[model samples]
Target: MLTTGNDTVLSKRATKTANTDEFLLTQFEKAEANLFHAKDNPEGIVNMGTAVNRVMEVELIERLTKPDALRFEQRYMHYFNNSGLLELRQAVADTLTRHLAPDNPVSPDNLAIMNGAGSCLDALAYTLCDPGDVVLTPTPVYTRIFTDIEERGQVDVMPIVCKAVPDNAEESFRLYKETVEDKILETQSAGRRVRALILVNPNNPLGDIYPPGLLLDIMKICAKYAIHFISNELYSLSIFDEDANFQSVLSFKDIPDPERTHFIWSMSKDFALAGFRTGVIHTCSSSVMKCLGKIALYQCTPSLIQHASATLLSDKAWCDDFYLKINRQRLRDRYSCCLARFRGAGITVRKAKAGLFIWFDLGPYLRSRTKEDEMDLFQEILKRGVYIVPGTQLYCEEPGWFRASFAVSEVELEEGLKRIQQVVEERKQKGQVSWSTY
Candidate 1:
């Protein structure tokens, strides 16, 4: 028997979970319950908090529903490979080889397919570390990774706080090799084992892609400490910036620790198929692959979904030649539109080169630069029928930073921005300084 702060709890594990922060999820549920549908429910909540790509929904549905696209066979009705259907794994491997690892062709044998990226993270956490072991990632990141690694694996995530340098607004929230090594050593010295270091390349919330040089340096540090390196390159194809050089870890010719390095990706983001529930892990380590095989029974993707995913990936004419190119252009267009609106509203936003959302500074809207003030502003925006993620949920040390997804329908995007602008105007009328004035 256990009790939480509210004094109503059952099991010890339930109390532990109840004590964890779930504000973002709670808001998401509320937003979903009353979603804004332009012609249906215009006054309902316009969701910009969730990182989903709805801009290409029509294109995806059209292609996926083609006659030959998802033909059902007897194989679909029977149990297949628990890891992934061979055809799907090979298709995934081939796609990665062509795009991410041109130099080193990815092998299907090294791939483990799971239900989704969240499940992949959970599986990796369980396989790579024991309960209470630490996995380090830089902040502020996708907040869900904290629970994905912790809830089932009982592992802990230690954030290497990467605060932006004061007085230099132009500088990005940079993660240094020294900072990472120091944190790793400090954690180990404290009698706790640091088993892995996970990074979301082309980072979430920030929407900045890491440099190749920095990635190499970080890998060397992980190798020096003999810890696993997991790169969540979920947005590898979401790079809309023409000049941005996005490199995959698999492309590196010389890996310091090939056996310990792993890559994660999913159809949810790149292909705009969140409902598909398909994710893959590419790892060279035989031991890790073996462990993942045993765990796949619980989290394996369904055969029919795997077949459809394979068909989509196999069609180079549609996938490589058409879908990706158009998706990137659409992403660029939506991002540009969202940016212009925010700038026009006298708000300051960090320009994003990749990913679905934009990180912007709303510090001027707050009465004080505090988390409480940030939440108050968030609630105010929510009251205006718009939902954007507050920085506090992302473990951001700084207050008044928020994320809003631009990967939505033009109408929804405009409506969300309009509501946000209304909030800003209301706050301004009440004496809050405009972001542009700063």
Candidate 2:
């Protein structure tokens, strides 16, 4: 009922939105196609390139063993029927109590395990977003957030533009709150119902580490508006910089209504088990979660992922170690690499606070060429051996923006930057960057 049909819910104010091959799945798809023939070519930096394999090299391998986890691990027993073991959800509650809140403890009854944060998004969207609802969010959000929201044409979208926070990732939490309120008011005046607000900690494209004060601002705004506050904390534990990491919105026990705010997080990013594909959605609201359950009835998580997720989720010690590893692996130095190179070339980029990505401004480069021509130039970058996510692909009017991940090793990261620099030089020389594509 919440499906968007084929109509994409962009923005009501903007007539033209910029989308380039860089932002879409083109580079990844292209590299994948290139791989079909070169099957023997050991997976190289030609893909998401940010070192998803970092987890593979983790020293903890001896602890997991070669059998139970990879092949014969019995964690697969819980499958689709796992409403989620009480103990696993309790682990999340325990983490919240230990790290964010002590007064209010979350119980298993408040949590449910889904396929991934994306699944939780679908369930929440289905539950709260009816036909023609509007999802209020910020720009340059995770690309899937848009596709998932727009997938069900029921809700139109309103993107509140966030300003660059320079070096403070946690500082943007306050910025996001203030801007979202402004955008929500704008839409309310236009006669559109603002159904919910979605947030990604450390952000998806920008990787901004939002501070605690900012999160309180968001919690206050959401509580005041009576709108559903959907927090995607999947990357919450990936805070590479400690000073930048703050308590999550879910940490606020005084939340006006426990049920009004919902949380989505997983062991994927933190545990380096993305391939494991199971995640948890927790909320104190019984009614809202009840509605979410109906949607889950349609597409349950695979049994195997559920079992593995439980193994890691039940152990409290594993939770601490997981967060520690992610925080340690999160590299802020990548900011220095891309910015030094790009800014030196006159390209403006935003500062990345946490997580593995950095978003670059390309408006200066998009001044020439048609949409298709721009795609061609983007494809050329793939030939250079470094792949990136384009801004337009993330659904924003801004041109000349792309994302790079730094989860790779120091060597691979340096090499990727060199390739990107080489390609930037080629584009600048040929005057190939295009802006008219939107």
Candidate 3:
């Protein structure tokens, strides 16, 4: 056992949380009828609960193999040059003009096919950041990007604090703007050039969409300081409600120095094409795009996935109907199930307009522990057998916040909700002031 007598211990993703991400992979228990546990390693007991069942992990992976997908995958038989099928890239560029662009639609030449968002991020870092540079980002970041920018690229990551508007119907752009402004000023004043202002439109763990105006405000600051703006909009189409859906920065007309803006998109979330591993980096700069292409020339995405995405792009109705409909419904349903259960139990659920998650507020429970690291809440939940990504995985400075993904089926979500409720109930019985609200 490790001791957590220091307050700063919670700052790092330690052995406890690191192993937790791996253990999050689970299987349903036939013996218990309604519990989740490790799939292959029987002795690897991480989490068990009435809320989630792990029995269908194999089946879940199999669902990606629809006959249509097979046909889609087969269309990639004509991979000629390493630039990733010109027709496919063109299709992507055309679809992007419809989906994102305003006046200056991204030409096919401005797009660089990437292995995934990770590759695009790495390419950006390789092109921009020196080892001593500082990369400014908000808390609850894209976890994988942390590795590419900070670990692989060896750049400093400055975390900007984000706050929520209490009692609001949803995410407040006001607070986000305020926090970002403060960080910009602080970094600039410290004689550090914030090389890039990276943002996740629908924040990963928080699951909230930033307002377009907030994005514009951020752009002004970036332009003022000459910092590159990296916007990851992979979950752009999964907004639960239509009004919550905002335009991409690529769609912004008044953005100063449009060439400094880089947009990343993929077929992962909205298409549930998670394994497809398709993404594109779009910009108006030839030099930037050429640099991005060199990286693609080295580590190319799967020829088939790229082919399928291109073909899929040509069929806009499929994107609107199949791709958009499936994920959006799943987003709303899972969100409702999770929120209703948690809120019914009096837990304060954060406001999320879009995305497949609701950032959880475990502040109540963490404050209750009084003398433990944030991992205490995570460990306790695992002992009950519910796997969730701790907020710190996204480089969140606040230890109490955690993420609950709403990407599973409705039935699974309901079960997961029940397990969380069970955890709350058990903690209450122990006379500890545990959390029950959403």
**Model number with the top TM-score:** 1
Stretches > 4 Å off in candidate 1 = 1-11, 18-21, 434-438
Indicate the worst ten consecutive residues by lDDT in candidate 1: 164-173
> Could you tell which candidate, 1 or 2, scores higher by lDDT?
1
Candidate 2 residue lDDT tens string, 75-172: 55534344564545666667656655666666777777776766677777777778778887777677767656655444666677764343333333
Per-residue alpha-carbon lDDT of candidate 1 for residues 316-420, written as tens digits (9 for 90 to 100): 999998999988999999999988988888777877889999888888889887888888899999999999999878988888889999898889999999999
Q: Is candidate 2 or candidate 3 better by TM-score?
A: 3
Off by over 4 Å in 2: 1-26, 35-45, 49-82, 99-103, 163-178, 314-323, 330-347, 365-377, 409-411, 428-438
What is candidate 2's CA lDDT for residue 391?
A: 60
Q: For each candidate in turn, give its C-alpha RMSD to the true structure in angstroms.
A: 2.8, 6.4, 7.2
Error of 1 at 396 (Å): 0.6
Query: What stretches of model 3 exceed 4 Å from their correct place?
Result: 1-83, 102-104, 164-178, 367-373, 434-438
Estimate TM-scores for all models: 0.95, 0.79, 0.80
Model 1 scores a TM of 0.95
Candidate 3, 22-128: lDDT as tens digits:
32233224223434433544333233221222222343345435554335444456544554678778887777677667465867777787777777787788777
